[model samples]
Target: MLQPVPFPIRKECPPGACICERERLLDDPQGDTRILRLTSEEEKRLVARIDSISTYADLQHIEERMREQLGIDLRISPGMHEVRTVRGFNIQIVERPGLCRKTRQSIPAAIRRCLDKNPDIAYAILNAHDLLRDD
Candidate 1:
């Protein structure tokens, strides 16, 4: 089953300074990204697609694809137990019973660069909870 995640929309920014389209919320001034915990069904769906990955090269290809397609620099650590941003901000994706939450207010430099270059990509990742929400 897909659980509902609350997305509180903010709408209080000065004219020409609105971040609603950039962060999908007018209140997030620090650009913290939300982490969505995948449900069992969602996890299964993802695992099924990448289960055949048997080498580091395969994983790297997927990572490159994600960067190209989503504009988010995702890196799976060498330890293979953690995922992080290019600047090393840990990104944890957990199963049910673990609630989805936001990252720390400190935006990593890699993400900051992406935001500077293209706010749209930052917006897509920042408000991923809403875009990927099941319902």
Candidate 2:
């Protein structure tokens, strides 16, 4: 994963957006992490699947499946747990803001590399996903 230092959260970040970006660096000063947005299909499926996840084991299973199928990791962020809802819980997935040069360049390369390797996947990572800002 191409991880970058945690840039401060922006005012625009939704009220309950994840703080994992902040905590990750504290846990491992040298750890590199990449934040990726879910594809529309992935997002839809996640909304449906989340309702079924009632336990840690269930969540792990879904996370693994997401990784295998979407090439993204699903982590439980602090914001996710803190959010309140009447019917269901809230989940936020945000990319680190103010990505450095290396991190910014890597995103396009990663997107292209995935496209080149898989002819079956037919979406433009650069265009299809909201990569830069959470808005």
Candidate 3:
């Protein structure tokens, strides 16, 4: 398989390894991480999706609203999630891919229901995205 990092390697990198981009440089005295560079099409898609969303329409509302408000278009619909604070009481909802999808409509509701029904949970919050996990 083609490696994400260039082959033939280099002396600077440790032998038998090709670290694409570490979150932190362990060997370097000053740690550094690369910033994301999104493609034009990807940016367009994101804007299109975001345009469609609204307050109560669920995360999908953002995407739909974006499309309506702007000429941009998107083929993919991102996801959303709800999370509980460290206290395990307060709730905050955020958008995340692992949390929602086109076919999966019950994630937010389920989270809200779980929070509302669970006396132990004081509140909950959503995971904004899985960007860190996504390659």
Best by TM-score: 2
> Per-candidate TM vs. native?
0.28, 0.29, 0.20
Over 43-92, each residue of candidate 3 has an lDDT whose tens digit, in order, gives 44543443333333343454354345422232321333333333332223
Runs in model 1 with CA error above 4 Å? 1-45, 78-135
Clashes of each: 0, 1, 30
CA RMSD for every model? 17.4, 17.0, 16.6
Which of the predicted structures, 2 or 3, would earn the higher TM-score when compared with the native? 2
Summarize candidate 1's per-residue lDDT along 5-91 as a digit string, tens digits: 355322233456422233332234443322232333443443443444444355457557544532335532222333233333233
**Candidate 3 off by > 4 Å:** 1-37, 60-135
| Tens-place lDDT digits, model 2, residues 8-95 | 3212233344333434433564544333334334444554565434444554576577556434443332222332221122122224
Worst 10 residues of 3 by lDDT: 96-105
Give model 3's TM-score versus the native structure: 0.20
The order of the candidates by TM-score, greatest first, is 2, 1, 3
Cα RMSD of predicted structure 1: 17.4
* Candidate 2: C-alpha lDDT: 0.37
Candidate 3 has an lDDT of: 0.31
Candidate scoring better on TM-score of 1 and 2: 2
